[model samples]
Target: MEKVRVLIVDDSILVQQILTQMLDADPLIEVVGVAGDPYEARELIKKLHPDVLTLDVEMPKMNGISFLKNLMRLHPMPVVMISTLTERGADITLQALELGAIDFVTKPKVDLSNTLDKYEFEICRKVKQAARVKRESLAEQYQRFAHNQTQKPAVESFPTTKVMPKLSADAVIKKIAVPSKFPKTQQKVIAIGASTGGTEAIKEILMRLPENTPPIVISQHIPAAFSEPFAKRMDTITPMKVIHAQARQKLETGHVYIAPGNRHLIVEREGTQYFATLNDGPEVNRHKPSVDVMFRSVAQACGPNAVGILLTGMGADGAQGLLEMQQVGAHTIAQDKLSSVVWGMPGEAVNLGAADQIIALDKIPRTLLEVLTLLN
Candidate 1:
């Protein structure tokens, strides 16, 4: 098998070194070259012709975002971001994703050497995933991204390869009892889960939704620093109010609740009302805000009153939970492979007979709204 060739672009010598080492450690990956800036990276790209590029947000000569814009517009390919775990970093990383990055790895803030093992797994896995992104799929995303950029100059919106013990949803929340009883409440709830290409996918769906749509709960794999900004960003573009989920927060019509990155967001029913609850439990499917946890909770709390839509992402985090939702008679949808940047999650759901409908990214909003109409 040909190793995935990678080019590292960072201004810091230490970062370039660390990234190179981490990527090289993976037998499936090879560091073809390293560049200190975008200008140097351009020259290296022409020579090395790497399969993927690891980019840093901060760099001299030209910032990573600026370089990324030029690269995507002129020569689109797989690119993964190296971002810090700060508010500003989160914002810039989100912007990079909108611009066409396949994925990202957060840089360690403290005790760098100590975290290299964990960081190694994350960076290597993302690079490999980025390399696997179909060129046609990436071109489609860039075209959409370019179109969105022209409309408004703003942000937009994977997977588990972990060295640590991979735990299932049971590690965090128990599975629903057999022959789960449907909740008596007739009010409907919408639950969405995604990872790799989810931020933008979720944004596409949310922006198209009517202001009067049902209560929405989303679980997108993200870090603690990024989820708040992501919710705020969605609030600006979408018609509904987007909020970071808080424990015991009431689910309201025309409002969206997003799980915080560090905690699991679960839906619980109290009498006739549904409330969002946060769980600080062990990571499920290698994600704190695991989609399985949220989907499972929704299945238990809302049953047939719920709608589960698994969007573009890597890995199989939400597949079983979506199946649970389906078994309870909830309408389920999965983003089609051609429309998904990485079809791992939604594809898994489809394979498990979880989705009632399979729709493209652009048509999901319409399909979801139609489902909402019938359910109501």
Candidate 2:
């Protein structure tokens, strides 16, 4: 197999050097070129023909969002954003993803020398994941998005490799035996887990749902700086009140709770009501707000009265937990491959027979609504 060719685009010489060193260290990736600005990047893109681009959110001459917009419109390709751990950076990075960037990695806020190994592992893994995306599918998705359609594209199957061994959901919560019978319940809760293409996908689902939907809880793999901003953005667009999950926050209907970055969001039942509980446990499946932890908690708390959906993402983080939900008699759904940006998570769940139904992206909202009606 050919190595994934990458182009590093950043104004800072230090960032350029760091990115180059990290990507080149991966035996499956090669740093083909480096550019200081969009202009230099354009020239290098034509000359080097890199498979993926590591773009900086803020650049010297022209900003990364503008360049990304133009690039996706004219020359569609896979792009991974390098962003700072600031609110402004998070907003801009979200915009880049809206414009067609595959994923993003945050710049280190602490000493780079001390965090180089972890940072390198993240960036390199993202770059390789971006490289695996099909260009034609990206172009199709971009055109539809340009026309305000909800249809997303599919990614070609690629090996989901891990740079370092990762901990499973068991690190945070132990698995318990699933009960053969579950008591009927009138109240229902919705649990969602996503990564990579999730921000846009989540927005699509939320924007289509009515304001009277059940209480929704989400665990999207994101950084600490971006979660609140993301929830704010969703609240503005969706009919539901979207809030960043607070410790021991009460879960209410017509509201969506998003897990804070670096904290596991779990569901617990008190009397007849549910609440969002936050955990500061170590990373599970190499993610702080692990979907596995969230799903497992939902399985335990809601049992037959929960709906679990795993959307597009680049790893098998939530597969087992989704299965656990199924075993507990919860209705579970996985995004179909045709509309997924990356099929790793959902596909894995399907393989495990965890999904009660496999649905397309555009149809998920209606399907969920129908299922909720049947449950009631």
**CA lDDT, every model vs. true structure:** 0.88, 0.88
Q: Any runs in candidate 2 off by more than 4 Å, and if so which?
A: 109-117, 149-165, 177-184
TM-score of decoy 2: 0.91
Worst 10 residues of 1 by lDDT: 154-163
Predicted candidate 1 versus true structure: per-residue lDDT over 1-376, tens digit per residue: 9999999999888777778788887899999999999999999999989999999998888999999989987888899999989999999999998888999989877776677567787788889999988767766777888887678532212002211478888988888573456647667999999999899999888887767778999999999999999999999888789998887799998899999999999998888799999999999988889999999999888888989999999999999999999988889999999988899999999999999999998988877777766775
Model 2, C-alpha of 360: deviation from truth (Å): 1.6
lDDT score for candidate 2 against the true structure? 0.88
Off by over 4 Å in 1: 110-114, 152-163, 178-186
Candidate 2 — which pairs collide? none
Per-residue lDDT value at 64 in model 1: 92
Clashing pairs in 1: 157-199, 157-200
